[model samples]
Target: GAGIKSLFGGEITQYVTMMEESRDEALQRAIEHAKDLGANGIIAIRFDSNEISDVMQEILVYGTAVVVEKE
Candidate 1:
């Protein structure tokens, strides 16, 4: 993905900021979904992104939700 400079003046770039926010939101949603399905944990987590347009992008976070048993 292409990088963008911060409009407000900062060390962190816009692209990095966007990705961080997106990742946090996606992970939160994934965890909530897993909980709804009665999953104890999420495994094999992965993140993927695609450029939808010049100034737009899509982020996807996926993982397997599994139940664990303690012996």
Candidate 2:
């Protein structure tokens, strides 16, 4: 899954807020996907983002979903 946000203004605070929100949403979606796949946890997590337009950015989160058992 992915999260997208648009740059609303030139304010640095707004940019930081939007970037964080997008990252968090993307991570949440990734976690949900892992759970749906019956994974006990996710490893090798990675995040990437790209600018779709001058005002738009897209964030993606990916990881290996795995099940672990206690010895």
Candidate 3:
């Protein structure tokens, strides 16, 4: 299994828009990373969240991306 790493902007408490955008940004980064690594697909995706400050948080997205050989 291959791995890719991605990180997005920190989250903000009570800011739904920012939080949502951060999550999306993280996912997009992960996908781009996989693409750059020549992965044909990504699976078993997961996300992690951490508190960055009293009103801020961080979002992490990761998954297994594999390269496939076409016959």
| Candidate 1 TM-score, C-alpha based | 0.79
* The best candidate in terms of TM-score: 2
Off by over 4 Å in 2: 1-11
* Model 1 whole-model lDDT (C-alpha atoms): 0.86
Residue-wise C-alpha lDDT for candidate 3, range 1-71, written one tens digit per residue: 11222346543444666777788999999989999999977898998989989978999998998887879
Better-scoring candidate (TM-score), 1 or 2: 2
What clash pairs does model 2 have? none
List the lowest-lDDT window of 10 residues for candidate 1.
Answer: 1-10
- Over 1-71, each residue of candidate 2 has an lDDT whose tens digit, in order, gives 12324465344666777788989999999889989999989999999989899988899898999999999
